[model samples]
Target: MSLLDLDHDQRKELAERVRQDYEELKSKDLQLNLTRGKPSSEQLDISQRLLELPGTEDFKDADGTDVRNYGNLKGIRDIREIWSELLGVRYDELIAGDASSLNMMFDLVMYAHTFGTQDSERPWNQEEKVRWICPVPGYDRHFTITEKLGYEMLSVPWLDEGPDMDAVREAVKDPQVKGMWLVPTFANPSGHTVSQDVARQLAEMETAAPDFRIVWDNAYAVHTLTEEFPEVIDIVTLAREAGNPNRFWHMTSTSKITFAGSGVAFLNTSTENIDWYASYAGARGIGPNKINQLAHARFFGDADGVRQVMRKHASLLAPKFNRVLEILEAELGEYDVARWTTPSGGYFISLDVIDGTAARVVELAKGAGIALTEAGSSFPLHKDPNDRNIRLAPTLPPVAELEEAVRGVATCVLLAAVEKLGA
Candidate 1:
């Protein structure tokens, strides 16, 4: 029965039962974690072949460019082509960089703050206020970048297909709203893929700022749990057709697909934006790790090779995701105290416990030696306005440990909900 439907005495009895369950959970003294969506050791082992790639003596790219040299600011052609096909960008427009896409994202924000975008009248720092549109139940690191820069972040509801279009369209009417953080496909926690209609609206919408931009983070472009991959929108082309040529700064990486510690990052955008980025990026460094780029290129011979790798990833990740769903349903469904996403692809399950009970659930998990991403982490500035959301990562732990941890979390969910009910 729904907890709300239960009588006072029933609630008290149920609370007592859950408290006993909580005590049992703590007594186990388990040290399991579901804090970050890191790939498991088995998942990591799928790409061990990367170690032998572009072997020492065979370090030259297909074009015979020596990868060890400090040149090729645009990165190697072969690597760029593979990602271009996968990311829906032209080969010439893509720039392969070092491991982390987060680094590239940070750099772009700093670059814009100091130098402005290709279309900007002045640097972002010179402006009085720079507001960013952040889709809630989104990526935390994306929010952290703008937060660390002292910029204001506005929250927008992320619907099943994408962010609430009407809200985003209105937000951009203010000149202070400069950029937005978006993960177009299989988004971080919610796994809300942006539909073509939404993508077009974002591209075509009129805005007050000439320099309005979107950080098109395709972090999970090919990271699908299902066999059918999500569609990739031709965003840059759509923007150009809409007369907003420099509207997006695309970023992607193989950190999850291959070796997380050593992976190739990609940046794709308009021709003008590329030129603008190169002028500034060139001043900062000679080039990215071309040797590493060559190694990645050799590992994934083509676009299909990347998809094939993602399938291996799916084989390992799908079960953990399923187990979490099954546990959540079995433990929390009857009480109607929790709801979660059943994602076709993505690393996280966006769990929402009873209203105002997320922090309590997380706290309860912590007391029982289970580590979860902090409550409210999915929002800008680490604040969930309703305090109703939690991001659960199931990819990192073994299925056995994941099941136990999720059961503990479900127990905490019930305990917290009942506590809130009594209050």
Candidate 2:
């Protein structure tokens, strides 16, 4: 029965029972963690071939450029060519970088602060008050970058079709608002993809700042956890068609597709934006890790090769995600106190538990030796106004451990709810 349907006596009885279950759970002293969206060790093993790939004899790229020597600052031409096809951007528009798109993303943010974009009036640091729009229930690290850089963060609603563009349009009216973070496909925790119409509206919308940017982080372009593959709207094309050619910047990496630390990352944008980033990045380093890029290129020789590997990833991930949903349904479905997203792709499932109970849920889980992503982490400055959202990552744990961890979370949810009702 729903918690709201319970009588005072019923609530007290349930509370006592839930408290007993929780005490027994703590006695188990089980150590299970669902904090970060890390890939399982078994999943990592699938890409082990990368270790021995692009062997001693494979130092030269298709252009016969000796990759062993450092010269091609734009990354290996062959690798760029493959990414261009996989990412659906012009060959010259995208440049391969070292692993970690997160690293590349921070670099771009810093570049804007230091030198500004190709069309900025001045460096962002020169502005009296610089700010960026962040959609709620979004990536925390994105907020961390803007926050650490001293930019005021404005939170907007991220609906099923993407960030509420109406709210986004309204937010950009301020001249101080310089940019917004867009996770166009399989967004970090919510798993909502940006619709084509929303993409067009963002492209065509007028901004008070002439150099406003849309930092499109398409980290899950190929990481679908289901059989159906939905195509992402061509944001670059839409932006250029809307006469805002340089308004968007796209970043992606094979970090999830291959070895996280050794995979390749790429940045896609207009030639002007590329030139702007090149000037800043070139001065920072001679070039990216070409050997690692070469291995990735040689391993996934073409676009189809990339898709085939992603299918393998789907096989491993889909079950873990399904298991998470299954546990939530079995334990909390009838309560009417919780709701969760059944993501078709991506590494996380967003769960919204009873209001004012998420922190308690997390606290109880931690006390029971089951770690969850800190409550309110999905919001800016780590504050969830309602204290209702919880992000569950199920990939890192084995099936048995994941089951136990989720059950522990469900128990806490019930106990917290009962306590909230003064049971």
Candidate 3:
């Protein structure tokens, strides 16, 4: 039965029972964490062969370009081809670089901030006021980037289909809305995918900002928890067909695919935009780490090789996600105190506790030695106005520990909900 149906005395009885459980949890001295969505050791081990890849003598691309030397600002073609086929971009258009896609994003934004994009009338820093459309229940790190750069991050509903297009369309009518961040495939906390219809709409829509850009961060483009991989939208083509050739600054990385610490990152865009990025990027460095790029290319001979490995990842990850869902269903099913996403792919399970109680739930879980992604982490400025959403990372923890942490989270949710009522 829903907790709302309980009378005051019944509610009091329940609260005491839950509180007792919470106190007992604290006494157990548990130390379980579900905070960051990091790949497990086993997942990392799957690609262990990468450590010996592109060995000392094999440091040159098929084109006979020595990777050890510093000069392919566009990176080695072999690595670019791997992701290019997977993400559906042309080989020459995809530029490979260091491990972190986030860094690539930062550099892209910094470039525009300082010098403006292909169609910019003036640099973003010189604009009277700059705003960015950020979908709520998004990656915190994405929000961190914009906040650091002083962009007034506007909230758009991140729905099952994708960001609410009507809202996005309305928001972009203002030219000051320079750009937006999108995790198009299996988005960070929500595990949502942008439908082709939505993709087309976003591409075709008119924006007041001549140089408006979409930071299409397809971080989980291949990070699935199921057999079927979601479609990798041809966003670059979509925008170009829409006459917004410079619309998206597409990015992806092999950080999770190979070594998290050292994998290749990529950026794909129109000819004009790619050249613009190269000009700004060239002044900063002679070239990216081509040796690492070469190693990654050899590790995954082709796009199918990348797919074969992700299937292994899905095998290991699916179970943890399933266990988390099972526990959430069993523990919180009756109370109607919360609801969460059942994502087929992506690193997080976005949980929403009772309204005005998410922060309380996190606090309660922490007291019981359970760590969760901070409350409001999936929003602009790290503030969930209703205090209802919490992001759970099931990938990092072992199954046994994940269960403990999630169960504890359920207890906290229950206690927080009842306390809000009992008072």
Candidate 4:
């Protein structure tokens, strides 16, 4: 039957059927959660060797520096080399550091607001207000970091190529616009990759704020679900070619690659920016744990090792991703009630329901004994302007559970769409 032709009675009957099915499923009380982007236990098991790599006798690096010691402020060389390849930049451009690259990103914003970037006329903190361009359907944590620092967020629409370049150009022309937060590779929530052309255009922009740096967070650089990989713009190279040498700050972590809380992270940027950052960061801590760095070096060794590990992750995660997609396709593909992304790689699939229906869909899913990432969690300040986007995280749950959870979500979507259309 054509969905468009369904009368009020038919729609009401379908909604009632959905509710009945949901009640039956809820009676199972099957506690299932698909709300987080964490790797499954099986995926984590692949890196168990990392925990056993460091024994009393094995506590030294390639240069014979005691791993137990604490003097390598810029991180051990071998770890830098591993992340250098993982991030697709030169070893010199990367600065391997402690486990949280997010922390480094936070510090960069603080630095800009206080000390300012290489070409700033004055400190940003002294200004009346500072603004940051945030691509909607972006990483919440990235948005939170800037918001916590009191920077005004300007939401820019995220398109297939990248954040709207036209919007970005116009926004950055305002002097108060200090920077932009970008997840260029396999962006969080949406799982979208910024195209090389977009990257180049971003690099070439003539912002009114001289200190405006693109906070490029390449968290999922190696996380791919398809054989054909997305091309990363090598923003460092792009900035140089654009003659805006200090225009980008790149970050990545081995958190997903090795272990979540106990992995190495790094930052890459122009030498001048690095020098300015180090002047403060160097004084803040003795150094990152060099021992862990050496262990990761020994574990992955090179780009090939990193790729091998990623393939293992792909094998474990691909099934769960496929299950969600399959269920969504089977149940909802016939209807124009909702749409979702088929990401090549990344931790999430962003779903967009009929306008103004996302919140109701989420509520229905919860009532049916399934939990999802809250509606509007993808946008800055937890507001998707159209109220349509929902982030689906398929990595945390096992495939069987994912299938059931997504099916429940599909029912909720249809019911919500019908109700909205009726209203």
Clashes of each: 0, 0, 0, 0
lDDT tens per residue, model 4, 172-228: 989999889999988988888898889889999899988888889999988998665
> What overall lDDT, based on C-alpha atoms, would model 1 receive against the true structure?
0.91
lDDT of 4: 0.85
The alpha-carbon lDDT assigned to residue 407 of candidate 2 equals 92
lDDT string for model 3 (1-423, tens) is 889988888888888899899999999898999999899999999999988988977988978998888898988888787788898887767888888889999999998998888788999999989999998889899999899989899999998799999899999999999999999988989899999999999999999999999999998999989999989998999999999889998898988887788888888888888899899889999999998888888888999999999999999999999999999999999888899999999899999888899999999888889988889999999899899999999998889988888999999999999888853
**Deviation from native of the Cα of residue 400 in model 2, angstroms:** 0.4
Query: Which model, 2 or 4, shows the larger TM-score?
Result: 2
Give the clashing residue pairs of candidate 4, or none.
none
Q: List the residue pairs that clash in candidate 2.
A: none
TM-score of 2: 0.98
- Name the better of 1 and 4 by lDDT: 1
Q: What lDDT score is found at residue 318 in candidate 2? A: 95
Worst 10 residues of 4 by lDDT: 225-234
> Sorted on lDDT, highest at the top, how do the candidates line up?
1, 3, 2, 4
Least accurate 10 contiguous residues by lDDT in model 3: 88-97
What lDDT would each prediction earn against the true structure? 0.91, 0.89, 0.90, 0.85
